[model samples]
Target: MTIGVNCGHTLHGAGSGAEGLFREAEHTRLVGQALVDLLKEAGIYVADCTIDKADTCQEYLAKVVSFANREDLDWFISIHFNASASHKGKGVEIYTYKGKQYPQAKAICEEMAKLGFENRGVKEGSGLYVIRKTRAKAMLVEVCFCDNQQDVDTYYKIGAARAVSQIIFNSICGQCRQGENEKSPGRVQEKSKEQTTFMEFVGAIARKDWKERRIMLPSVVTAQAIKESAWGTSELACKANALFGIKENGWKGRIYIKEAIEQKPDGSYYKVDDTRWRAYDNWEQSILDHNNYIATRSTDGGRSLRYGAVIGCCDPELVCWYLQRCGYATSITYAESLMKDYVVKYDLTVYDKP
Candidate 1:
């Protein structure tokens, strides 16, 4: 099946803060390119549909719809960052029509969470043109909340685009096996069993021994780390050497840093110094922290479904979708960005090596 990837917007005057101005339109374009590169490496058909000069989301969506129709693509994934007036929220999220398209939507969302990302959950939308107009299964991923410094710092790594591309490659093609198309060099290859394991559930940990585990594909891990740690360039990653961007926000024994940001209790934005996460000293610490965070939420009484939906069940994309439903971040485009980048970047195959 053919797939299309697009960055949510051009880099020019894109806003930051809760307004999303941190990344220039050019940065978004670069991110888009990273996604395309990863997917192509996985032997998947990837389409390039970034028109960075567009002035508005409406115009951009229209261009994407037109391209999908003309290309006859089987799926369309739009990449984007999220913004909010309040920087209190964060995490990964996915969006779909919330109706019949929910199945594909579920798949997309789960894949993202498995790739790492605070599960935001899948949401239903009638206003999103890409999902409404495209003939193929369309989903959008909001990698993280740009407004939230923690989210932004965690997800906006310099090499995040490339990392995201790897995850998307594994998610869609995780069912395929390695070397399945070796005989026909020109044909697209399928994902190997390694593409669908737990390592795929979170970003790469940089653990040498991890190779022994029958974990998911390397691309997926890379994407998750990119999304969570901004491709290993976040303050947490750089200072603490935490590659996966795990936080001990509520833990009693863990260490963390605090930062100031705008927050809203009811309506107006207010300054708040929330506890920020410190990068883990080692990959295992980060992974264990992440696991605890997810597992703890999974048992939070009546809120299990909501949390479960965010992380999703066995399906990786569903985890992303559930995060959206949980309001992990305000950005509507998180999940789309992750999937699109992962598929186009050839990152999915990186796991084949030791």
Candidate 2:
């Protein structure tokens, strides 16, 4: 198959991609180049039809279309990131020319959603210049919202450029199958077990980095991860890679908006739909950021450490006590719950050393 891939927008000046947690133009180039290489690897002819230095938006669009028209291509793809007025629009959406159906677009959207991005599905591009003007069968991909911090976090978590390229490539060329010569049911179950043990994966990552990152007491950290992330099955954990219930306040990184159940001081629970939590690229980063939050969090405008009592504590239970007393969680029995439910139940303190 011969194809033309256009990384939409310019690097700078007019027609630049959206700017939010990341630069859309830069990512477009990254993804576009990645796609070009992947298709070539699959023995398909590909052309990079990007026009990055146009004087104006109109010129940029015209040049890309003109370049694409010149190529003897079977398919044309334009990659872009969307933006919203509230800086919170999220998800992956693919577009085809008006009244046109491209199965590749549908497949790509489904593949992206598997990485935890919301699937906005394939839509008709009624007036898009790239989709409308291209001579070949055209599709434009809005690979998540640039201004949405939640989407940005997921983008990097799934390896950004490489993930996007692979999804698009696999959608068009079929996923590369490995180790699958029709596996037996027992083997399938074993693989499923391996994939489902992600909590252990997070534990291994936390243990490996706690000392180097200067985070003390992996026992408490692990317990907190278990309690907060619900053994790695919580929506926040699965979707945002957020281990702790860390809020988005004062966080410079991306944010995920999730509907969470907030506990009251009276032991009652309330539901909140717009809770903003910090998002990370992976569980390791989530653990590191949680450590930072613990070390630097303060109540009196950074004048005093909120959880200072446990800074250098050697006892795991003591650290939990300090966290509970310091208002780390809203649960009335937060410390007790972490201790009895996770730390002791799972013998987590054994991982505190080395």
Steric clashes per prediction = 75, 0
lDDT of 1: 0.53
lDDT of 1 by residue, 104-171 (tens): 44554565555455677777754777778887777776766666777655554533554555455555
Name the lDDT of candidate 2. 0.77
The alpha-carbon lDDT assigned to residue 267 of candidate 2 equals: 41
TM per candidate comes to 0.45, 0.50
- Candidate 1 off by > 4 Å: 13-21, 24-27, 55-57, 99-116, 156-159, 175-354
Candidate 2 local lDDT, residue 333: 72
Per-candidate RMSD, Å:
18.2, 15.5
Show where candidate 2 strays beyond 4 Å.
177-354
lDDT tens readout by residue for model 2, 1-354: 678998878888999978887888877877886676467434366665787678999999999999899978899989999999898789999888783657788888888988899999889896898888889988999999988889988998988887898889888776642113134212312223533365467667667767666555777887788667655645577789997869986999889996554557744334466789999998889988887787888879989988788676778888888888888877677787677656675667767767
Question: lDDT of all the models against the reference?
Answer: 0.53, 0.77
Name the TM-score of candidate 2: 0.50
Best-matching candidate per TM-score: 2
